[model samples]
Target chain A: MTFALLARCGRTGRIGLAIASEDLCTGAVFAHALRSNTGGSVTLGGSPGRNNTLACNLLAQGYAPARVLQELRANDPQCESRQIAVIDRHGRVAAHTGEALTRSALHRIEPGFAVLAGAAVKPSLVEALVQSFTASAALELDERLLKALESAAAECATPPRSVGIVAFGNQDYSDVDLRVDLHGDAIRELRRTYDEYQPFAAYYLERGKHPRQAIPQREFADMLYAGRSGNTR
Target chain B: MTYSIVARCPRTGRFGVGTATFSIACGRRNESVRANVGISKSQAFYDRATDPLVLNLLAQGYTPQYALGVLEAQDPDFQYRQLGIIDRAGTIGVHTGRDIGPWAGHAIGPQCVAFGNGLAGPQVVEGILGGFMAEPDAALEDRLLRAIEGGRDAGGQASNGQPRPERSAWLCVVDRGEHPLLDLRVDLHDRAVSQLRRVFEACDRGHLRVDTR
Candidate 1:
């Protein structure tokens, strides 16, 4: 019912997550959190409970992504329906999906990146997600992570019901968090919403720094997507 | 960063708010309910000050509309904020600032108001409102959850629409008690909406139930 990617930008040190599901409110139930100068984790699939949060805490404590995932899998009673991915501050990544959950449950790993998807998803879609992420080196971390979701969701036989992406940097605050909760095209909506919010992302940071001031809001010309338009070929 | 709805159940006199956001633990800051008084939410560049002020105004016996107006008048950043209020009497008020994100808007329904910013289009407001209205007889928490689910369905641009998960979701509902009768949250999870439902189902129904080994 779902797939998610948890990764950190080696260049910017920002943590990013992109997720999509036919299920409702995947963002709320799934795992997410990153400590600044520490690490992050994402829990998805069948049994996403407190263990997901435990994974994140372990990552924050300086556990290697693989070791944290290992400890979680061994401790959890129901590993068959769960998917988890962890990334350390150093950008090392690890992922696990319960094999019993789906015939097609799979993952793709690359340096500084990991893609985890459930059994219902085709391997091709999972590959598309990672390939898209790996190919988008020139784009910002948010754009890259989002395009990967767009690519993966595009391959579904029926367009996914929902999709979302959240990215946070050196601070615990989000640089961008866009969710197309109930859209015909969640990724497409995310693109539009992200485009709109991108210009003002810096303003929120400033607002935090100066809580008393009525910060000025300005409009900037939309940032153009270069080679990657997020359209399915 | 946030969008939410706070409403009262007519038959039961219970209060609840459904909220979801891109930020972590927005529930702790965005929601306030005085048992049977009222509820209000501030999002799209949320502030720590708004919910508390709305709660204080409600405590002073301010109507939802008047309370929202006063809060808006006092805040210089009101233009960038989206707020919705519903008192225990079911009086409803909502404000969407000019400088709030594009597609920023709200739909005021009878006994409730749904609002948000950073949406794919104005349809998101319509979606939340319609979702809330669809299940008129369900529990307030379920109704709010479904309503926001409608927002997810309302998300995405034109064609090739994809449903997006609510990044973080929370609900607080009260029965005849002064404290939150059912307080549940899914914080910044990949499947926050689902987790929210799971926890609520376990916690609701006149008793407390948590899965413990």
Candidate 2:
């Protein structure tokens, strides 16, 4: 049950999420960010579920990182197995990995880069993945997300027998942004899949043909809606 | 006991070999024999020393014959050593030294070469190479194993089936490509070549286990 989350936060724009797991598709219970790049958040997979609705409200209310962390820890039922990576509009990023994650798991933290890679990875993977995206030389959010996946592959404790990558933004679009999956040679498979989708970004913009598959209704519609309707409204 | 090998698979257009004889600078001694040829096996008894290097060098562009020639020339007492080669066209070639211990010989066939020294007779290398060439369509790993079995049947090692512990044994092969698709090693094992083959199979299957989650 490896979990991950990646988002793009534009100062005056949107905050979105893209995540994938080794079990069911993440669409089941993944939550989108609220307007102002803060608010409710939840991502559930299988028997274990992760949510932070209260923490999002506190963050929106301008709570500090340390406070948010403390709030999260206080509510965590299985602190040792949980993991999280959060990046706010201000570029404030926070992460956590439960000790319960597999022993091979490792998290790396750098100024603009954070990485968590391992088998049975915990919440810490979010931090490392986001960091890799932030530090990559990719030109766009999509490219950054792809790079993060590559970084994860390079640092994975045991080479993932399979792999994938996903990304989302608060932009009000009618289509999904990214999705990748592989059954054989994850590195090569993901890279190829990413290439296939690359044209969608520009092609959609050029021919006005946005792909219907790219959009995740919850994040695209709700997240962008809240972001656009300022608190004053 | 220093061991060095350099060979090529003519049919597959691939070349490589690696050898080590429990001594420091073993690679250097083997290197002199290998010269600018295919590859030199100058290390502890590790698998892939010769095959990986051969495949890599072939990818870098070196003929099968020239590659084997370099290593052969370097060994002053060529008769006492072991060597094998398979050219780009699957032309097999090999030479085991007369000075080589009790069991030293080589076998050449349509597209395979097999040779070994120190326990057994020329029949060992001949049997393996003949069996390998006869089954040209077999999987690479399977063919390699068959060759090993042939060597064993021809009085493998000096152990005489006594299960004498050995520090090392090795096996290597090349895909029909520029780079070696697999390189495995077991410094110590009851059947180094066999174990190396198992690891190769695992790597091949690793990609097939996908996680759609």
Query: How do the residues B74-119 of candidate 2 rate in per-residue lDDT, one tens digit apiece?
Result: 5443443345544444444455555434444555555454555444
Misplaced by over 4 Å in model 1 are A30-32, A200-233, B1-16, B19-213
lDDT of 1 at A204: 54
Per-residue lDDT tens digits for candidate 2, residues A195-221, read: 633433343243212222333212232
Native A-B interface contacts kept, per candidate? 0.00, 0.00
Model number with the top lDDT: 1
Q: Quick one: best TM-score, which candidate?
A: 1
Q: Candidate 1: how many backbone clashes?
A: 33
**If chain B of candidate 1 is superposed on the true chain B, what is its TM-score?**
0.85
Candidate 2 chain A TM-score vs. reference chain A: 0.59
Best DockQ among the predictions, by candidate number: 1
TM-score (0 to 1) for chain A, all models? 0.84, 0.59
